[model samples]
Target: MSSTTNYILGVFDDEDEVLHAVSEVKSKGIKIDEVYTPFPIHGLDTAIGHERTRLPIAAFMFGTLGMICALSLISYTMVFDWPMIIGGKDFFALPNWIPVTFEGTVLFTAFGLVITFCISNNLFPGNNVEPLDLRITDDKFVMAINLDKNKLGQDEITKALKSSGAIEVNVK
Candidate 1:
């Protein structure tokens, strides 16, 4: 069982307005729950104090695992499973393993990054997304502030949002 929280969605028509609103609201000690934009807004994450992601490290780790598996499999198949000689190449032909190893590394890195992103963003299959506004995914930028958590009066919240240049403010 879970509880539903009430939020005030501050709508802004421009990215610059949203950026300014984030700084303004935070400066006024009003915590922003989250911000949604139709597309990536440069410097918005930084303005909102979001930390840098570490997905690249995850990709590198997965790629290393794939490379190790590929190398081991190639070496075992060629040298131990069934020894073979082709084009006067050595049984443990390291050069022959490069292409497959590279492919495996690339494949694992791509898939790993995708999985990591989905997991990190909580986008599992059958998951439902509660959008504050349909236009948020289309053209609008919205900032959500949890009223219950912030413990601010509705009038005060509305005033803060309006002062920060929000085009519209609505409760949800």
Candidate 2:
């Protein structure tokens, strides 16, 4: 028999059950860490009481920061910082700064946003993941709670899951 780990928390049998359980849990004011599903479920976000993600805002801010940095660096280097006369033109010329500034801005912005995204998703080069269940990724739904280290009442959570329409429940 495959032994389930304590950190595995609780698993609910199906997607609908998981959704209902999430709603019920939220109604009881019990905060859930995360809900894993095989596929997208309509109204799942609301059921889990998840707020609108701030990822887009973070990406926008990072991109904007990158744009400003790139623009300033290019602009300053070509004009004030270390002005260089090129093609018999004025060192502080505006038109000539456009191409480099635009390119740098685009490059830095894309990189900054992408790096932020990777970091947020925990997609580093090598990372260990603790998946609650295989079926949760394929067909079932899993709800995990980060209880205060062996402080969880398994029976209570099991009862809650069943009451919320869990088709079946498991410790892992």
Q: Quick one: best TM-score, which candidate?
A: 1
Candidate 1 stretches with Cα past 4 Å from truth are: 1-3
TM-score of 1: 0.94
Task: Give the TM-scores of the predictions, in the order they appear.
Answer: 0.94, 0.66
Clashes of each: 0, 0
Over 1-172, each residue of candidate 1 has an lDDT whose tens digit, in order, gives: 0138788999999998999889999888888888999999999888888889898789889999889988998999999999999899999989889999999999989888998899988899998876878999898999998887786688898999999998899988
* Alpha-carbon shift of residue 48 in model 2 (angstroms): 2.6
* Candidate 2 local Cα displacement, residue 114, angstroms: 2.8
C-alpha lDDT of candidate 2 relative to the true structure: 0.70
